[model samples]
Target: MLVVQPRSRTVVVLAAGEGKRMKSDLPKVLHPLLGRTLVGHVLAAASAAAAEQTLVVVGHRAEQVTAHLSEIAPAALPVLQAEQHGTGHAVRLAMAAAPDATGTVVVLNGDVPLLRPETVAELIAAHESAGAAATVLTAEVADPTGLGRIVRDAVGGLERIVEERDASTEQRRIREINAGIYAFDAVRLRDALGKLTTDNDQGEEYLTDAVGLLAAAGAPVGVHVADDVTETLGCNDRVELARLRRLLADRVNEGWMRAGVSILDPATTWIDVTVDVGRDAVIDQNTQLRGATTVGAGASVGPDVTLIDTSVGPAATVLRSHAVRARVGAGASVGPYAYLRPDADLAERAKVGTFVEVKNSQLGAGAKVPHLSYVGDATIGARANIGAATIFVNYDGVRKSRTTVGEAAFVGCDSSLIAPVEIGAGAYVGAGSAVTKDVPPGALAVTRASQRVVEGWVQSRRAGTPAAEAARRAAADGEAAHHHDASGTVPGDTATD
Candidate 1:
């Protein structure tokens, strides 16, 4: 079977709108949706559609937008639309930056992050196949308020597009509205844009007028109705931004689900676009995986976990923990409440148990920091046991130091291993000990004070003639009653006095 390839295309993204309705100082296109900014998502879709070149037109916060684009999509050209005239003016500026070519050019809105790559491909294909001068993406939305309405001829042939302000009562009732996305033959688009005039009610050049111009000039215009209306939704305010974010999150979670990952509750599972989850991984409710995180196969994450830029190996379980830029090897167990900071690495089968926090540390295979411990700037060898309430005191007044525990070493409960220290292999540190110096192999280190006996101290303090005699009589009575009870004698059967 022969697969027809899509024609070479260039994409022009209009991102210059001030978006004053958003009431934010930041440019609307720079607002975040899912993990990437709004324009970032548009650029991603453009890249996915295999555009030969992409140009972004910026005006509001142009410097910030250009800087971010350089970091995320450096290949895209940025053109400045100094005046906020209209969409047509923005596209015209972008077209000037785009190379002169005969292939199709796609115009997209930067705030429409939910637009899919396949839809763009479809529009291009339809434009090329129909040999139309231009193709406009349209949608049948429930409310066409504040949108341009698409008017058709009697035989349902392509006609002109009218903006809402200029539409008649009947045209305003038309449900099919222009979706603010278009594909056009490069030469024809340039010609139509040249003929655009600011004669509309708003005295602004409308891109929709270009479609009318092309139709009037005996050039065939095509209309492609998007299957999902939400795909054409653009964010103009905070509410729409949040709606788009939720939609994008749902799309990401659905993709993971289809890849054999089990998401117990997708509504509460928020995975970013950059996250990857292997097959058979079980992500419980309220788990948020963000920023280049990867979850391996058979791993169990959450009921409440947030992993940022962290890697979890196969079969590892991270329960109710927060990890950032950390690594957990296969079979490792972390949490019911643990924090793993940057540079923390736990080897296979290692355990970082409840209330434990690890930072810039490494725990070898079979190592255990079972509970209530802080292991920072330290290295624990295989089979080393870190008992409850143990702390590696790694920071002095000026700087931080490291503590190292050799293989099979046992750090007793309530012990503090002061930093710039080491414990040799198989060494034992007694409970409640604070060791500031190194311990030799197979040795026992104890720093606690020795036992001290104070004989008859309480008796000497409480002794008095009548009071001490009454206490002695009471003790004798208590002992006699205990002996009677042990012999199964009833209290009432014994003499009271």
Candidate 2:
């Protein structure tokens, strides 16, 4: 089959509206939906369309939006609208910013976060195929209130779009509403925009009027109805924004599931669009994978786990943990309640057990930091065991330092390894020890105080207390046992003989 690709063109994104209905200090386009801002999603779609360039028209919070664009899409230029005259005026300013723009110019609204790149490409293909001067994307919605209605000619050809206020009683019943996304012949769009007038009640130049002008001039105006109606929906308020977020979440989760990722409870599993889940990965209930996180194949994450910008290796199991900017190597096991902070790295077969918090540390392959331990600014060698209640004392009053445990080292429970110290290979750190100096290979380090006891102190100091009475009773029982042994009358011994 012979294939044809659409000619390269410039995309104009209108984002200058104040969005009064949204009632937000931030621009509507800057509102976050999934993992990105509303305009960010649109810019992604526009970039995926392979346009020669993209121009964003900014007015409300223009500086903030421009700064965001620099971060998300440095290649796209921002054009200042200066004043909000409406969509037509925004597009006009965008065209002025890109005077050399040619071929098809795709226009998109910044608030439609669910708009897909394939849909934009389809619009362009239909426009080019029909050789139309302009093509408007439309959708057949169940309720079209407050939206521009698409009016068709008697023969079902393109006519014009009528806003709700200007629409007649009969036109009000039309289910097909203009999506406000368009693909136009760049030259013709420029000409039509030049003739737009601020003659309406709002005294603003309307982009819909340009379509009527093109149709009246005998230029073929085309319509491409969107297959997925929800994609055409734009955010106007917090309520609509929430609806869009859910829709986008469903879309993202469904895509991952169909690709062999097992979402055990999709309702409770929130996966960002930027997250990647490998095949055979199981995401359990209440799991949130955000930012650039990636789950390897055969990984099992959650019952309740949130990972941001973290990577889970293949066959790793992360149970009820929160990790940020961390890495779990293959076959690693983390948590029923672990906190893996930034730069925490657990190598293969490593175990970060219950109540362990690791930060800026690395656990070598087969290393285990198990139960109620804080391993920070440290590196544990392969096969090393960090016992329960161990603390890697990495910070002094002035600065932070690191502690290192060599291969096969054993750190006993209740031990604190003071920073700037090391436990060598085959070394043993005794229980209750506070290690301040490095130990040689195969050596034992115990810094706990020497054993000492004061007998009968409890009886003498608290004669009337329960503890004193218990101690006296224990002493009397011991004397009676000694008397019985001296008399060769041990209880239960004669019967056994």
Candidate 3:
């Protein structure tokens, strides 16, 4: 159901928790799940609610966390809490930032990234309709032992909330738990925040205590128990983070699997936040598609490959390859150990064989790099045959260089095209040649070392040998003489044989 739209609602994200358990210099909210920040989910939830603005409350490692959030461009303000007092104290710091606020203020947890927009809207609507001073978002947990329990009044109205540390044995029986999310009348929230005291057991001002104070003052305090606890799960540790991510992955994978993409192992395949898999695309086990990577329709990604910031066109096959910042066109095949670095482009039907590395190069349609080769800073034209072990010697002592091969050019096995070199269309580079200059069309460039032999070398050794050894050496010398004479060729001319 569409909830009542508020005149204005400012979402206050509480990311100030020390999160000491994370054990990292980076803020807890910065931990990535499938290539997106944990706090991004909270911002996304607020956006889904059509929030007028979102405000993030930051404290520990606030600067680093805020810097990262700046990249996402959330529709919210950032409220800094300098002191590590408490949750209430954290939200209180936001008062000066949103002073004279009269509409709804939806308080959210920055580490809880699984929130849904619908639930947030409901929280705001519940507060507005009832004109409540404060409304807490609650969920029924099977075991609400560690969480704060929502203590409802006899008439099932909001009475007070007690933290587990301060709760009595009787109060602990309440299965309904506080999710730490709230929507309050901005004016009343501002007023109540000032009156709050740090009299709790932890010597911290508890936000839940305000509910009791509001209720006792005859002001309305509301409650909105969300249907699913999973949406409210807060990630403070690695285990919960993984659990929440698996939950999220299941949702994302199921949607794609239903949409005709094939995931061989849902448990093993991981996809990033912005990746898109086309129809009938098959993603095998342990494959990770991250950072805006797109697999086109009918394309097959590895049972074990990592693709980052790359695009694979339809029917392309990338098997066991690490492709980063590259583009693989339609029907291209990248191999079991191919590495395509930044700016590499494999055009339609191009083949990159095992152990080959291409960096900042463009392989045109039907071009083949078969086996151990390095093509860096080069351009290869259509139907070019890159024989085994070919290396585009692109880097000199100071600056990197480029090599260009034209259409139908053949680079023979073990050949090196030293850059600033170009092979004209239909040109050939003979085996084992290192071509440093351009080769004209239809020409073959052969760079071979001279061959020389010392005649009667074995006969010379016979002078120091015994009689039998000399005889044995004579037989081997006859065979060696039969195999060669001059020009490194035997004198068995076909008709002269």
Best by TM-score: 2
Better of 2 and 3 by lDDT: 2
lDDT of 1 at 472: 76
Judge candidate 3 at residue 223 and give its lDDT.
Answer: 87
Query: Roughly what TM-score does model 3 have, to 2 decimal places?
Result: 0.88
RMSD of each: 4.5, 2.1, 5.5
Best by lDDT: 2
Off by over 4 Å in 1: 1-7, 99-101, 453-497
Candidate 2 regions with alpha-carbon error over 4 angstroms? 1-6, 469-497
Q: What is the alpha-carbon lDDT of model 1 when measured against the actual structure?
A: 0.91
TM-score of each: 0.90, 0.95, 0.88
Candidate 1 on 308-361: residue-level lDDT in tens? Answer: 999999999999999999999999999999999999999999999999999999
TM-score of 2: 0.95
Give the better candidate number (1 or 3) by lDDT: 1
lDDT tens digits, residue span 1-497, model 2 = 11237576899998888889999899999998778999999988776557889999999889999999999999999999888998889899999889998999999999999998888878888888999999999999999999999999989987888888888999999999999899999999999999999887678889999999999898999999999999899999999999999999999999999999999999888888899999999999999999999999999999999999999999999999999999999999999999999999999999999999999999999999989999999999999999999999999989999999999999999999999998999899999999999999899998889999999899889889999999999999999999999998887886559
lDDT of 3 at 4: 58
| lDDT for 314 (candidate 3) | 100
